[model samples]
Target: MKLVTLAIICVLMLNSCKNKSQEEPQNQVKVEKIEYASFGKEIVASDAIAAKSMASHYKTMKTGDSIDSKMVAKVNNVCQAKGCWMRLDLDDGNEVMVKFKDYGFFVPKDITGKEVIINGKAFVKEVSVDEQRHYAEDAGKSAEEIAKIIEPKRTYSFEADGVLVVQ
Candidate 1:
């Protein structure tokens, strides 16, 4: 009976240690809001929060960089359909399409002329011609308009979670 009790006590002690070791650090990292650049402006992420959380934050991309989760520049273009989205231009000369999250909020179409900050993932992809046409249709474009929709050769797409609209 004594040996069984000792064995159980050892197991419990080991389990407790294991659990404690698996716990995360007490000091957690907080995401800070940041602003990006414009079409011609050379704005960049000048904050520490962006530096620590995202490795590629504010770094210019040549290719294969998707604008999904990164602080990126705002592209210069207005969503002509419903004035819902403000596009962002990435450092790689790739246009990162920016829109409010969950359709919860929207910026003025004229805001496209300003600088903004976005935190999200960046995806470099070639959207199929069909998908492009579909988007064009959704934007209330005519068949000729849909045909004019430029198929994405390679786009650095940014899907922002939280955005800080900066002038």
Candidate 2:
């Protein structure tokens, strides 16, 4: 009886391991952040100040402080559904949410961790719960997680007229 149970357990374990391996693609792409894009569409390089400088420029301001400027930054994340928005990484784990001006262009959904210079109006805004939920849905977050956004949150945001992604 003991030998039979051990054999059954080993078979089940082997099956589970096989299933897990099969679930992953053999050609799975490794994502990496870069000064130039490795996974998204190519673009000619242009110049802008570093992302740190943009953050520092507003160190003493409260929400609603707006600055019209161009800045270069790393793409932290993009909207998984439509590429309608992106989050730019800043110093100290901060991020600025960016949306295209007049819905003119959408950043590539796979441009995570690439560098780009954006010409835009940057400001801090209090994102309402409904807006937060909408973004969570756009990002493909689970319904349970979206439901947890009950309070407003303030963060840096941008409306970009043009963006030049580095090659």
Candidate 3:
């Protein structure tokens, strides 16, 4: 009787182990292939809000307010001199100025019109005329265009920890 009980327990343990092994594969998550060119800290392209939604968030933000977020948008322009900064179209007429965090990374200068996902802190601020002119120069704007930035402008800004340019 004792021998029979021990054999039953052994059989049950073996069966349970077999079941767990079979279930392991099903429980594993599928990792999709990465198809983006990465810059700065690596980031996955998941859970990023669309440009339209991001625009709405910006609309609700006041100057000095900031939120941590990830968003996808089309590149409207890039710093012509060094790709140090980029402007992303929010699907509306508004564009968000994105700069790398800690001056850590730069994107491709010719990425205009390409889609990208950026992980960052978004904020609204008043851009000084001098800074505006500086950015305009970086963008290779004409002297007349730079000169026209006389007044401070309220702008949507982002400090991106990572950027993924969709291929």
Candidate 4:
């Protein structure tokens, strides 16, 4: 009986040990209420909060750098069907495509011309023709318009986890 008890204790101790691979941090969402809310959804998180990055600052940064930039920029356009994506004016007729990280969240659809602060990682990418057409479709562009995308284009992209529309 004592041997069985000792063996049970040993098994219990082994079972209590934690694996290091399971120690990764989780994205805990914190809700933030807005006194004067815009057309978009309320702020769901404040992760890695930062001030907006300047357009020129983006132009100066090297590609592939891990950027957690909080940028305040004008909304050029949005995915009209759904707020799954948006384009922010980066000055000089340039724009950066903003998408939600992991398809986790979406912005307001009618937020065009409004100012928004986005928190995300920014990088430059060569978007393929197929994907560009898919984005155009998501934007509710005409079939002719999507067909116009024949070549891949290089542009800055941001994968945002949080977005706040400025008043």
Q: Residue 120 CA error for candidate 3 (Å)?
A: 1.0
For candidate 1, the 10 contiguous residues with the lowest summed lDDT are: 48-57
How do the candidates rank by TM-score, highest first?
3, 2, 4, 1
Each model's total of backbone clashes: 20, 0, 0, 2
lDDT for predicted candidate 4 compared with the true structure: 0.74
Against the true structure, what is each candidate's TM-score? 0.49, 0.70, 0.79, 0.66
**For candidate 1, what is the lDDT?**
0.56
Model 1 TM-score is 0.49
Report each candidate's C-alpha RMSD, comma-separated, in the order given. 15.9, 15.6, 7.5, 16.6
Taking all chains together, the TM-score of candidate 4 against the true structure is 0.66
Best candidate, TM-score-wise? Answer: 3
Q: RMSD in angstroms, candidate 1?
A: 15.9
- Model 3 CA deviation exceeding 4 Å by range: 1-34
Candidate 3 overall Cα lDDT vs. reference? 0.95
Spell out the clash pairs found in candidate 3. Answer: none
Please provide, for model 2 over 85-163, each residue's C-alpha lDDT reduced to its tens digit, 9 standing for 90 to 100: 9989876578989998788678788888878888878898899999989998998899899999999998889888777
How far residue 2's Cα lies from its native spot in candidate 1, in Å, is 99
**Candidate 1 wrong stretches, greater than 4 Å:** 1-68, 134-145, 149-152
Residues 1-167 of candidate 4 have per-residue lDDT tens digits of 99999999998777665443355334457777643233333443344233234556567776665566767678989998778899988766788899988887777787899877777688877899999999989888899999899999877888887777865
Comparison by lDDT, 2 against 3, better one = 3
lDDT per residue (tens digit) for residues 1-167 in model 3: 99999999999999999999999999989998858999999999999999999999999999999999999999999999889999999988999999999999999998999999999899999999999999999988999999889999999999999999988
